[model samples]
Target: MKKTDIILLTGLIGSIIFSNFAGFEKKLDKIEHEVLRMHILANSDTEYDQNLKLKVRDKLLENSDEIFGGCENLEEMKIRANEKLDEINDIVLDVIHANGYNYTAQTQLVNMEFDAREYGDITMPAGKYDALRVTIGEAEGHNWWCVMYPPLCIPAAEKVESDEQAAEDYFEAEELDIMKNPDKYEVRFKCVELFRGLKEKLSK
Candidate 1:
């Protein structure tokens, strides 16, 4: 091949690769901004440890009513979460000690990817989200997760009006439709799951 032709071909290939990467990154960013998440990891897969995780989760959710109720956006919720981290830790500690379990709780805010997850009538699409992660002891067990900012973890009856309000305030029409009926967007959901997996692997 001629030298100029070779140079042009290489540049074309590089541009294509760069464009695809940029598109993927943009999608990830969009997904991250759309929702806030929560994860509670138990110490082990044992029944007692798993139950303790729920105890911690329930207590945290109960105590978070005010913070979640007032927050209007992910950034606000994250700020409130940082302010209440110590209180959350104490709650977890109390639950552990009360259950006669000697384990530690670790909490932090992080960016993590999730597959499609259903919460009653709502389904969160697969994507990277900013979350409050609470890990107990080894943190090797199956975990519980929920949307904390939209307050989906709260009782269905109590949060119904709030959730609808939040949806109207926070999400776009198409996004809200997908969350409300994810099965209707099955193909897109699967594609999101696949890309999330790819993004996770690339980051690792």
Candidate 2:
């Protein structure tokens, strides 16, 4: 996403946060979680069949014990999670790519090694992905998810750059309707325009 595109989205998100402060927490949580998964999917370029993606993701979630040995608490669990994060990320990418899109699967979870999807186009920090799980597209549809500490991007700083705060501050998911098919608002419009501009630049 472009820098200007992010600011425009910021305006849209601002509206939701203000109007729906009452229902904001739950709403934001949903959006946050979805975006993380979506990010993987979007970048994965995996197969097009949603059913396949569902099956693979379900298996991963279900087999957590086999994939990860029993860990007692958050810290130990986190260590295990980080390891599986890479494997899970790879699995999802394989599913998506096999199904049929053209995306690059990126697994860096740090905030700094990140590039802004909406704004600064900046990179995030490099470390454990402790703060949030941010995927760009969901299996269900066109939206995204955000959450704290998803496994894949957690412990791979040696492998990747930072990924912190790489996205815009999102509004309540309900307000933006991002969980479902997001309406093509000004943000989408700007995205279209950005693509056009880039095309023109390339032509030049």
Candidate 3:
């Protein structure tokens, strides 16, 4: 092969790779913006504390409708969450006290980093996301998280066979495709994560 021909071929390949990465990045950004996650941290990793964490989770999930009902979009969901922060805190405290613990809980809306997580058949890509974080007492134990906006965590929520169907209303077809078929875009997800991690580090 001629040197010029080889250079052109390499350039074309690089262009294709860059284009794929950019597309994935855009889809990831959209998903992040549309989704709100719930993060609950326990006081400690002891069996008792862990069980207490779940009790708090149960109480919150039991009241998911009150906390998130009537919210149309991510923005609305966030506003409603902020408006009900005190109520949420009260619920957490009530559960803690009822469970025979003195641990205090704090509820707040915050933007934070999350690693790639799988829920049933869906694989959410790693990135920064807006989360309703509830920290219990010392918050030194393992944590639990889930999608709150699309009502994924609600027990009475609709059951869908795939990610595409589950988020069809909130995501474009191509974006849903990426999430539905994570294995097909595994490399691209990693690339996007690497770039996002670097950007976050640099910003800090």
Candidate 4:
């Protein structure tokens, strides 16, 4: 199958579009927002983490082809979607560990708890904390999101997709104009949603 033909699990294509796309943005903008949200949502869930998610998602959208191109199959698609997420997780681990944070894979959550005082940080609890997330190939939206154990979960596949020949790209980027896109109407409506969100957020 072509790299463009990589299909997520039978039902998740919509969630990917809706959630990743942020549901109410223009086609191109939606893609950008969704990608950004992933980075934000994946973080250990702090203000900085959320902002970073938005930034990374935008970067991923700018290089949709690079991101999407890597998804030649189900496995590849998950990895493509998760590329930034994995990188961020690695960075978070390094910082936490350096500060004597415990990286315990208890039940697979990788609990990273530390003394805020040790890091000279404030407003954080003394309890153990870790990144909580829905694993790759497994987000189900209002639909059947597969199993739930810790932050990771399994994907539901009808038939396994064919193997992909390439890994995901991290930097290379190009864009297709959404105005002339095959789904122009969808893009138009989504754009309005994003505009409204911006207006509302800004007005507040």
Predicted structure 1, TM vs. truth: 0.72
C-alpha lDDT of all candidate models, in order? 0.76, 0.41, 0.85, 0.33
Worst 10-residue lDDT window, candidate 4: 162-171
Task: For candidate 4, write residues 1-204 as lDDT tens digits.
Answer: 655555655347867766655543433332332221121233344444444334433343344454345344443544444555454445444443544544321112233332221111101112233322322111221111111111011111212221110101211121222322324445544555565568789999
TM-score of each: 0.72, 0.32, 0.87, 0.21
**lDDT by residue for model 1 over 86-115, one digit each (tens)?**
777888899999999889998888888777
Of 3 and 4, which scores higher on TM-score? 3
Question: Root-mean-square deviation of each candidate, in angstroms?
Answer: 5.2, 15.2, 2.7, 19.9
The parts of candidate 1 lying over 4 Å away from their true place are 1-31, 66-69, 157-169, 190-204
lDDT (C-alpha) at residue 130 in model 4:
37
- Looking at candidate 3, the ten consecutive residues that score lowest on lDDT are 155-164
lDDT of 1 at 30: 68
The model with the greater lDDT, 1 or 3, is 3
What clash count goes with each model? 0, 40, 0, 11
Between candidates 1 and 2, the one scoring higher on lDDT is 1
- By TM-score, the better pick of 1 and 2 is 1
Highest lDDT: give the candidate number: 3
* Tens digit per residue, CA lDDT, model 2, 48-150: 4445545445544455556555655445654565666677666656655676654344444432222223312222211123422324234344322223223
